[model samples]
Every structure is written in C-alpha cells, then in structure tokens.
Target: MASVSALAQVDATPRVSAAVTMEQARMVDIRSLVPDISQSIAYAGSNNFVGAPIRGYQAPRCWLKHEAAEALARVDAALRERHMRLRVFDCYRPVRAVAHFVRWANDRADQRSKATHYPDLDKSKLLGDYIAPVSGHSRGATVDLTVLRCDAHDVDCEPLDMGTGFDFFGIRAHTDSPEVNAAQRANRHLLRDAMEAQGFRNYAMEWWHYTLRLEPTPDTLYDIPVTAPTDSGRQAEIERLMQPYDGDVPGVSLLVLKDGKVVLSRSYGRSDLERGIEASPATGYRLASVTKQFTAAAILLLAQDGKLAIDDPVKRWLPSLPKVADGITLRNLLDHTSGMLDYEDLMAAPYEGQIRDAGVLALLEKEDRLYFPPGSSFRYSNSGYALLALVAERASGKSFPEYLRTRIFQPLGMRDTLAYVAGGPEVPHRAWGYSKACDGWTRTDQNAYSAVLGDGGIYSNIADMARWAAALDDDRLLGKASRALAFERQAQVSSTPEATWYGFGWRLADGLQWHSGESVGFRNTIVRWPKQRLTVVVLSNRNDPTPYDLAISIGRWFMADAQAEPH
Candidate 1:
C-alpha cells in the first residue's frame, strides 16, 4: 500500500497563478498539496515488486505542488499545440517503501504470479535483474512512468499494454521487450521524452523510473510514524490519560500498560550520549532481530494467501536444501530448531553484499554436513532464522522488507519503524547507534548493515515498539493458533539440556515471550507478558549495557507490582 515511485508533477492551472515555495513546504513534499492540469492522461509503468512494466492506468491520486502544477500547466499548454498532455505512472514515495520492493522481488513463494507477469523470467534470477538495495526514488525526485492519450474525443483512445506486468524482473521489464507492440513502445518513448524534456532522468533497467533534476526538497526525509487516525476521544485524552517517560537520563525509554491503559513511561540518559541529548520515547533504535517477528508475520500472511504452508519443508522451493540438519519442519524453522549454522559467524563485517541471507544457502548447500540433525537438538542459530528468511522471500513473491512493510509494518501503522538499509540519507529524530570504548562513542552499523534482514535490520523507536507490542497482544497481527504456537516455549538440548527454552525467535523466561539480539556494538531485548499486559524492551547501542540484568530487574519490578495490585 505504498506508492510505487516518486517525483510526480501535476499539469494544472495554478490558483492566483502562484507557486508554493519550497520554503513553505519544508518537510512534506509539495506534490502532496495541489492538483495537476492534464487530468485526462494516464501511463504505463513497471514496478520492481512484480518486475515488469504494466500498462493501463489512470490519473495520479496524490496532488502536485502549486509551482510544479503551474510549471506542468505551462508544459501542457506548450504541448497542447501538438495535441499532447503529460501522463504519469507513480509519485512521491516513502523511501522505506522502495525497500519493500526489494523484498517482494526476492520472494519465491508465488512463481505462478511471476510466470504470468514475466513469463520468460526466473524467480531465482532477481538480484541481478530488477532488485538492488539502494534506490534512486529514495532521493525524492525519481519516478517510473509512461504516456497515455490526451484526446478525449479522438475515437475512444486505446490503452497500450507493456511487454510485461509491473513488478516483473526479467527482460520483460525492459523498454525494448519484443512482447509489446511497436505502438505501445512508441507511447512509452513519448512519455519518457516529455519527462526528459523536463530534466528528469530515467532508469535504464526500468524505463519508468525518473528523478527530477531540480528536486522540490533536496536533503530532508521525514520519518513520519505511521499512526492510526485518532478519534476525538483518544486524541483529547492522550495528554491526560497517557503516561510520560519522565526518566530522560540514561538514554532509555520505558512504557508500561495495564488494563489497556498506559501506566508509566520513563526515559533517562542521553540519546546522543556524547552531546548530552536526553532520550525520549521518540528516540529510535535499531530493532535488530526484533525484525524477525515481522518476517515471521510475512510468512504467515503468505500462508493466509495459500501461497505456501508453514509446515512445508524448506526444500519444497529450495530443492537443493541441505539434508535435514534434523527432521526440520517449517515449524521448526520458525522456531529455530533447524540446525543451520549462523551466517553472522561467516562474515567479519556485513556491508556491500558481504552477508546476504541468500548467500547463506549457497554457502551451506555446498557443505557435506549438517550442524546437527535438523531436529536432533536446538541451537540459537541466526543461520536457521536466515534460511527461514529465504522461505519468507520465496513465499511472498516479495523481498523481506516489502513483505514486512505491506503485511506487517504498514498494517500496524508502525510508521517510524523501517527495515532500513544504511547508506541512505539519515532520517530525522533518529538515534544513531553507538559503540563506546576508551576511544569514545562511534556510530554502530545500521540494522541493514548486519546483513540480518529477517533476523534483524529493522530500526524503530520505543513508541513504535509499543504499538508492536499492543498489536501482538490484540492478536490482530496473527491468528490465535499461530500466536499460541509462536509463543510456546521450545525445549532444546544444549550443555545443560533440561532448562533450555526458545520459541520461533521468541525466547521464554518464566512463561514470558522474550527475545534478545546481539552483534558488533549493540544489544537489544523485548519481553511481553500478555496475560498481565506487561511488555519490556531495552535497546542499547553499546556492545553490552548489561541488558539481561536490566531486563531481569525490570521484569521483577513489574511482577512484584502485579502481585501487590488488588484485583
């Protein structure tokens, strides 16, 4: 449900013939405010999600800026002499949404759809073809598009079909696909020509993608939290009924909910621990492996679509899957019982394709051994979760980011949450992760750099995390049975066999649903006790903030308070 592309203009008459200054629209894009003039035009374009160019569309849904609309009006007027008008495919987008596209194209679950969209394409051949982690759209001025008829009275103007559907990844997404008729290709060229005339650059692989030379906003990208529309009651009572994280001291944010109401929240310590910027509920942290729950949610959504079954063997799609490290089920994969080795161990530092999840299988597929029989015992292997990440990719016909965004992140309105990659522009109100030593604090890697896409790579704030906990408690994110199964503790064999417990990336301590993640320079924890409406989360950038001890004490505090509260 995010926009397919970015940088759109409205061919419209400007009221007072005035243009809105970029100074006026400092944060939100100007394209979001006013209408365009050439309303009858439409376009054909391809999306990375489906990996092919799709034809037949309508006018833009989001509006254009007053100046851009006026500029478009001028262009339309000039083109009017030749019976031409601008057509569009997509517009201003959230950069995180582009990450969504990468996730979808990598998914193998819906081969049927791929076959229909790009008949000559291979689902396994996506990375080199359509998907790449970095995106031009993220720059805020690019778009994917094609032209349409402007002559409303000219004998029922026909819509041209592109060679393949939007989101197709093969040669079909190319502008020169033989499958499309010459006229259809000509129309595409016409739109491209118009945009190029306006100084917008087109992407070579995807002819629809274009970036404006003079962008409305150059460097500011807002990390707006996805929020539910607040009713008057909730809005009015929020300040009064809500709790505030008053501890702004140790760079930690805490929120406690009881009987469906927020009871307490405290934040302490500096967010910019060096600059002495105090932490607040808005201080964002890399969710780290807290992302897997959303990845698991994507797989379940695929199950809901009947695209794949949770209990299916991983080898069903990845036929070259190594022999059962144990008698592993997708269930076990979800629960991390598959004895797959942890991929994080293989990389010294993850960045620039160093530790991609897909590469893990290729690495393991060649080995003649299993860490253990798949079901023989359990190990807290990121490798197991990494492979299940592949299952999610294959099953959703989307990248891990897209699957989570569309099915999980967007649905819960965790607006500020993002399965974000690094190297993109820095976001606002975002807390940079830190690694503190005698050398002082240095920015730790972003979640995406860990190459732990499904197992980690999500960045969010305490507020968004709170919403995630609430969503899980409501069971709106997953079915009751799935939720019950996901939270059920797993009995594992380790050095000490009797006390080991884990559950689908969720660990259990005293019947609490919990999980902890660690990597270079950071540690994170989240614990939820649904029966008591209890949730705890601690995200620290330093290699060790003693999170386990802090979580234990916090959990004890909540439990003690529960015992004392009168029913």
Candidate 2:
C-alpha cells in the first residue's frame, strides 16, 4: 500500500503550482557518483503513460539530493558485489513533470497509453491510485528502479521479472500482489531487501517506487530541469567544437551518451541541402564501416541461437568459397585476422553494377589465394564481412537484412536502423551523402559498392544509434557471455603508435572501444569508454575530413583523464 502522504497527493481535485526556484537546493547528478548505474528515464521519453515527454525533463539525466544520491550509490555498490545492478526509471522528478502527469490523468479523452499502462483499470480510475497530483520524486529523495541480474564480470545484465513493467497501473504492479507468480514475488522481495538495507522504503502499491527513509527535503518540491552535468558551459564548448558543421551545407549529427542516457543530441547544417532541410537528430545517415559492429552482433546472435559458432570455419557456412578460405574461421573474419583479400581490389576496372553481399561472395569464390594464411596476421577485409552476412542468411534461413531487422534492429528498438538495399525498404528521414566540390557540396550518396549489405550498407540516425549503444551496454539483445566474447581482444591490430587490438567489430585500446566508418560521402565515428560508461558518436554526410579525430576530441572533453589511444 502507498504511504498516507502518497495517497494524499493523489487528491481528487488536482492543483498546479508555479515553478519553484532551484538556486538554494543542492542537487547532484546520480551518475557523477555511480557512473555504472543504468537509467531509462520514463518521463523523459514517450514510453511512459503520458505518451510524450513530460514537461521540465530536458534530458534523461537523473538528479537527486546530495545525501540521497550517495545513499543510492551505496545500494548500487552492494548490488554489484552480488553480480547485480540497479536500473533507475525515474529519479528526482520535477514539479512541472508531476503537474503534466496530473493534467494527463484528468483528461478523459487521452487513452493512448491505456492498453499498455493501465489495461484493467479505466483511465479515470487511475487518478487516485497512480496519477498523483504531487510526487515525492519532486523532493529529490525518491526513486523508481528495478534489479538487473548480471554475469560474474558485470557485463551482460537484464532486469528481473517483477510481474509488471514500470508504471503499470494495476494490482499486479503491487510489490506484494498475490496475483504475481512466486518468482516475481521473490524478485520484488529481493529489491525491497536491498533498498531497505540502504535506508530506503518501497511503496507497496508500486514495486519500482522508493524514497529515502530520512529524506532531506520531504516537503520541498523542485522544479529545476533535469539535465546533464554542468550542461550550460559544457554545451557551449561542445557547440564551438562542432562549429565546422554549423552552416547551410552537408553537416553532422552528434550524440553523446552517459550512464545509458543521452547527455547531448544536436545536429547542424542541412541533411538535404537541395531540399533546404536542416539536419536534426532524426536524420538518417549511411553508417559505412560503423555498420560492421551490427554485422558482428548479428553473427553473435545467430551463434547464441545455436545456428553458428565463432570458431566454426567460414567454409562451414559458405561452402561455395574456394579452398583458400578453408583455413578462415568466423572469429578470424571478426577480428580482421582472416588474411582475406580486400574485395574492392578484386573488382575489375570500371565495375558496372552495384555489388551486393552475394556478389562479393562470388568474387571471392573465384580467388585462388588469401593475402596470408588465415589467423596468421591482421588485414582489413570488406570481403570477410560480406561473406559473414551471407553466412548469417544461410545459417538463419532468412535474408541478411531480414535477420538484422527481426533479430537485431527491431528487437533493440532501433526502428530507424536498417541494412539498406535497393528496392528493399526506403530509408525514412534520409540524409543524402555529399562531396565537397570546388563550387559547393555535390550529392554523391551511392557508388558501385553502395548495395553491399554486410560491410557498410546499414543506415541509422543518432537516436536509433543511441538505442543500439544502450543494447550493447545492457543485456537487451546479447547475453553476458556473448557480449564479453564480442568485445574481448582477439587480434593485435597495431603496436606502433599505441597498443590497439581488434575485437569482433570494435577496436580496443587503452580502456576505450571505438570504430570509424567511411565510404563515398559519409564519415562517421563512435568512440566509447566502457569503464566510464560514456559514448560519443559523430555522423557526417559529407566526405572530406574524417570525423574519427573529432569524435575523440569530444570524448576527451567528457573524460576527466583520457589516455592516449589510436584513432
């Protein structure tokens, strides 16, 4: 059951107060202390019962009173010792956001989120039990979270089944509901025990909701906008860093993520210069080699399903390959140690049609020898990924693109991402690629190899890419063992300028995992510091200077002590 104050806040006659000043309150970003604590701020996005971003939630960052934040961090640390984690859905709600919830609850016509959030109860009936006029979250000591079970290495993690999803407006959502199964009840008890040990009390009516036993400011509500840490000055400095893309020409979309939430998302210049459309977060750009990560993930997923294995020889999947590829394994292809010849070099002069994945396989099938014995040395090979895509199709009994859609993209909520193929599916919110000509930028979106599905044909936007990154960080798609295997160092890429290794599709160097993608008219880079739980993505449509170095610079700004690493 909800506390007396919690019920009182759910008054029949709702009221909205003027925004309060936040200058006197000492607020802290929870991630500043608990960097690994996962977040999926429901009110900050359209996934909540409101069906839109609640007012005053500028970003998905979590904030809490200083004492509360420290206590929550302790809880997280204790969970980590047990190979588990705390994933917060809401923390320190704004008074305005609570008002937004109140207004939405009062409106009888809006039932858009009813089927999913409040299936059994009428929308009007939710006001007393769920849609409260005032929320303890505004006091900055309250939180909504669930437990995530993890592997021994704390890599792959998934939320425990607590009978109902976050914000579910039904009795099943009750922490001790008899309607829930035994496992669900035990999971709820597990969460309650951990939280209570840290001086927090759970609201019985909502399994996810919690408040500090000794709240620092129980009566005072905050209206301060929830934003990334030190957002003002840092945002300005980042804007200056991105000045090159701030004009009416082919530009870039930059997304910075920290603690599983967006820290920054901004786009500059025009996605379609001829159409006079400015680039926005939603503008999809060809990911080029960055698509390799997704390709690698698809194979790993198939392996999880018992369709294939990383150590399995390439010949096992694509028997059409000549004897030269007999020594190559899927792991070799992933780590760039296949010694496979580059497909581009094999294409005869003035190749006529766009080459697809199957065509790449055909070209390689005719080759007599690899550059070196498989697994002997590192050599970047686009042909390897192309064959891997075909292998995925053959093993899964589905088209490569179809496997990516149903198995990877759609499952991860990467709705805007796709393995682009001609006449397959039109990319929504497309950003045509560009080349810097003498007079102006010219559209050079596609070339002979544009249709290649595996190596670099997927198109995605920053928003979707963020979702993909989140999946990689959590056990949304791949399990802990699979994720660890994918990121583990397999082959040494370089030993000169700095120690760098290749893992599946990612480059590992000095505690950082990164990769760059370049094609005819797109240059992109995604740099991630897994330990720090930060990721920087830069996507450009114009072919000129590569964005890898720029992406590193942006990442360095966020990292307190960045180590020297390869681009």
Compute each candidate's TM-score over C-alphas. Answer: 0.52, 0.59
Residue 437 C-alpha lDDT in model 2: 88
State residue 50's C-alpha deviation in candidate 1, in Å.
62
In candidate 1, stretches whose alpha carbon ends up further than 4 angstroms from where it belongs are: 1-250, 273-277, 323-327, 348-353, 423-428, 446-449, 493-498
Across 414-493, the per-residue lDDT of candidate 2 in tens digits comes to: 88889888887988778899998865688999999999989999999999999988888888899999899888988898
Query: What is the per-residue lDDT of model 1 for residues 1-567, given as tens digits with 9 covering 90 to 100?
Result: 112432223343211212233223332322223222211111212322343322212212222333344444444455545554333444443334445555665677856455555566676666544555444443335544443343432211123355544445555556666656887677667656776676665555565565666766454332222221123442223321211111111245555555545565544444554433445566666666777776676666678778888778778867776665435677767777676766655544643555667877776776556667766677666666677778887877787777776777788887767766556424335555666645345656544337667777777776777777777766678877667666777555343543546666676655567777676555678877777777777766556564655665566666776788798
Q: Which candidate should be chosen as best, given lDDT against the real structure?
A: 2
Give me candidate 2's TM-score against the actual structure.
0.59
With a 3 Å backbone cut-off (N, CA, C), the pairs that clash in candidate 2 are: none
lDDT against true structure, model 1: 0.55
Question: What's model 2's lDDT at 363?
Answer: 90
